[model samples]
Target: METPSTSTSSYQRDDGPVRATLVGIGLTVFGLLMANVLTTPAFLFDPALLEGLGNGSIAGRTLALILNFVGMFLAGLLYLLATGRGLAWIDLRIPSRRDWKYIVAGGVGSLVFLFAFNIVTTLLEVSAAESQIMEIIGGDQTMILIMIVVVFLFNAPAEEFLFRNVIQKRLYAAFTRMQAVVVASVIFALVHFPMYVAFADSLLSTLASLTVMFGGALIFGYVYAKTDNLLVPTAAHAVLNAFQFTVLYLAIEYGIEEVQAEPATLAEVADAVWTVAVALA
Candidate 1:
């Protein structure tokens, strides 16, 4: 369970859980604030831009997604610099062949977890909150492809860097490894509550969705702890997202007729799938 933080002599003393929690919260807020400040002008000024930036439009959603990545990244970078650590401390090095095993295991584990959780939710009649969010971000084929690329390249890496590399590592110094994992995972799950709130119909369903996300975050944190390679968890996160998106794409392309009496357009289906994946991730 030794991380680069554990191995390095130059690492700073743990700031304790309270400070870590405060810093993590601060970073999240700062990122959101920055995104709002940066995107609001463009969102307001241009008519065509306004249309593109509509809630369900590809351009609008993509802009939001990119702003999220930028905000988290800048915040993480500032945190590291303030703490006297550099980018190297985050361990962005490419995973080795052995590390790849953990990455693959994480991906497989996520799929298994999601499958089991979905079955249980289905039995209990709990809806997937992400699906509703997807319906709001309607897009066409070109937009879908662009969304996939952005998600795979920017969103996955930026999120892993912020959560696993920075937040989890800092928390690890203040708590037992298991405690750190639980706490970090809780934060991770909680951060997603806004999306769930926007789309979930009932409290129980929202709780169920968060519970599944918490489980996934636990797996991600564990893999990062074990391997000490950010890429391992990032790969896993990307794979999980890719799998989910692929399934949605296939469902939209092939099963739409079977599922709906008058099927939605392929673009609409793609939009729904992409938006859901974005929210869930």
Candidate 2:
């Protein structure tokens, strides 16, 4: 029987619920600060250095993304060492046959949650805010391609490693599984507030955006709790993101939806892609 990659904890945690929660939060903050610091150089960034990276035109963007991911990765590694844990403490493994069932459910469940959330928001007359990540991608074929790769390699793995394996796991020391999932989800949702706030029309919109993010966190958290393999949620998150970019690319590329609007429909997105394929063929 093969086990996931993990290490036995040298276990010295003495903090109570409140203090322990704070520790997890501090790690999140540290990661963000470090990522920002690492990415700052991209502001005056010249693309010439990595001119032929992901795409020549998006060289600077690619560099910034790499730095940002590196910063977050380093933060997690440093914290792991500081806590007397090793790299192996982060649990990752190949998905077993049963694990794939949960992974697929996680991805499909997320989409369903999103659909239901959109309906509720509309029913409540809550105006939605533009997603910062989507706005950045903005239906650009090149940017979307870059993001598809980054989301799989860096974004999903780094975020899941920190929030799920590190933060959520730490909370288990002082809280129940449900409590830990909720707390970690709250942190996950709140961290996205800055991005949402920028495009928010009002407080309601910001809150709405956070609600969706919170729900997403919950979905991802639920999968981690069920599977216990960090790679499961990472794969689920990355697949959802990849599907979104592909759908969104088709939606906007064919004028089926505007760049700034939420995708109108998946059926339409697929239809557009088929149309293009046939035309090209």
Candidate 3:
């Protein structure tokens, strides 16, 4: 019998594994420093000072959002510095033609999966169908348009690069694909812990949020697997966030001002299921 070929696969680069380990360490350090920096301002600075500008004013909210966004970005930069990689290795470059095609497909797939999952949960007595964050924002068409543009340009893309592209990709080199995804997903969910506490409004809701996000890591991972391009996954991530933001905005503006007061119930759950089934059909 002929000896089996043992030639290494071309996808296995010389530096991938070593670089991945160092990057993971750097990311952990970066996250710690970022938390410290953000929390410090709260102690020395007056909470009222920010509140005075406007309680949940658009500009105030925007500033807070920017700070959170940039803080994570700085963390990612720290990782790059530690790993001796530049911005390019972080997968921050603009998407190419091929990247855009796969990105659209991934985006569509993300929406489809999101809808399906919601449907399943609804049938299981989980929730009613409701608009997501972006849907709410979109009701104010002018503001929504601007927010979408900003998100598409910066907020969405930046987060994707930091969490998924740079960090997740590097981790993949060290761990099995599934292991890498779990690590990445855990980090992704932890960073948004506050959101789960504030918006999710219940233990079950929080767990659901965890499931959605980790599943997101898998979807993004699928995009990367197909294209070997970060842009595709990044775009998908952006679309998902923007969509959620819009939905939440609309929900608040139109009805159900307080999530804590009125929880998603059995009827809502059925709505969610029906919506997904129809969409899939």
Worst 10 residues of 2 by lDDT: 1-10
Q: Score residue 118 of candidate 2 by CA lDDT.
A: 62
**Candidate 1, superposed: residue stretches over 4 Å from native:** 1-13, 41-60, 131-136, 255-281
The C-alpha stretches of model 3 lying farther than 4 A from their native spots are 1-29, 32-56, 92-94, 128-147, 198-201, 248-281
Q: What is the lDDT of residue 152 in candidate 2?
A: 95
Better of 1 and 3 by lDDT: 1
Q: What is the per-residue lDDT of model 3 for residues 1-281, given as tens digits with 9 covering 90 to 100?
A: 01112111222433455566566656755765674476444433435424332334444434444555567667777777766865645443466677788788777777777767777776676642222332223234445545666677766665676766667667756666556666776777665556555555566666666666667767787666555566778788778766654543444444533431222222232233334335445
When 1 and 2 are scored with lDDT, the better candidate is 2
Question: Compared with the true structure, what per-residue lDDT tens digits does model 2 show for residues 1-281?
Answer: 11432222332345599987898889999999989888767645764434323333466777777788778877888898898877766777778887898899988888777667666765788766766555455457788788889989998888888898888877877777678889999999899788778777899888877887787788888888766788888998898778767766665566654433654222122333445455445
lDDT of 1 at 98: 78
lDDT against the true structure, each candidate: 0.67, 0.73, 0.56
Report the alpha-carbon TM-score of model 3 versus the true structure. Answer: 0.68
Compute each candidate's TM-score over C-alphas. 0.81, 0.83, 0.68
Best-to-worst order by TM-score is: 2, 1, 3
In candidate 1, list every pair of residues with a backbone clash. 134-276
lDDT of 3: 0.56
Worst 10 residues of 1 by lDDT: 259-268
